[model samples]
Target: MSKLSEKASEYLSREERLNVLSTSNKAGENNIAVFGSVMAVDDSTVMLMLGENTTCANLRENPRAALLVYVPGKGGLQAEGCRVYLRLRAMEDTGERFEQIKAGIRARVGDAADMLKHLAIFEVLKVRPIIDLGQEI
Candidate 1:
């Protein structure tokens, strides 16, 4: 597995950022959803709390996915962002990790935590600039 670059890691840590997870089913039907429960567990891993929805179902059907993280700028490609390719590593509905994530969600968004049904763990496959101008992440 490859590691995330320092810049990419920093961008993923931004509190005021946008995260959109893209996944496709076994038949290649695509799905994208805005997520607020995403966090970089380290440079090589990311974790998310997901309900039993299309996103979770798609990941189970096809492990490949991508997370587009963006931190808005005044305007243009100069914006801070990166496209993080990921592979589903694990999905746990019960465990220490799940409980921890559940508590975190409760603290941040109260009742929204009740909707969390799975703790999704993913391995970072690659990271690229949002515009993909042949620039390094």
Candidate 2:
């Protein structure tokens, strides 16, 4: 079992959803977007669906991304201060690791099982948590 960082666990447990930021190369430039169906696969890895879209295209070119998961309700912006940035490397769609991620997603969002069946899964290669406990403003 992979143990997630204290910060990562806290964030995941508190927020049921995450915004995945995927960047792709477009004519030698970067394009980024916020994806809503992101899932936490263990403590270190984050999983999300990459449909046949620009975000997926960008990932194929450059498998790096950052994810921001905000706690729901009031003061959500303050929660943004604790977003997690990840260095991602696309994993091949085979083997046990892939299965593990699939299972993880199912466990997190059982209600969306039908929707997830059509989405492609990507994993986080590295994660960095940003927490501004000292910031007053």
RMSD values, in order shown? 0.9, 5.3
Model 1, residue 94: distance off in Å is: 0.7
Q: Candidate 1: list runs displaced more than 4 Å.
A: none
lDDT by residue (tens digit), candidate 2, 1-137: 13346666566665454564747564556666666556666666666664466776766677665566655554633444245555554544556755565566668767554443334444545444444555421
Query: Residue 33: error of model 2 in Å?
Result: 3.3
On a 0 to 1 TM-score scale, where does candidate 2 land against the true structure?
Answer: 0.57
Q: What's model 2's lDDT at 96?
A: 72
TM-scores, each model vs. reference: 0.96, 0.57
The candidate that achieves the highest TM-score relative to the unseen native structure: 1
**Where is model 2 more than 4 Å wrong at Cα?**
1-4, 13-18, 26-28, 92-137
**lDDT per residue (tens digit) for residues 33-105 in model 1:** 9999998889999989999999999999999999999998745867788999999999999988799879988
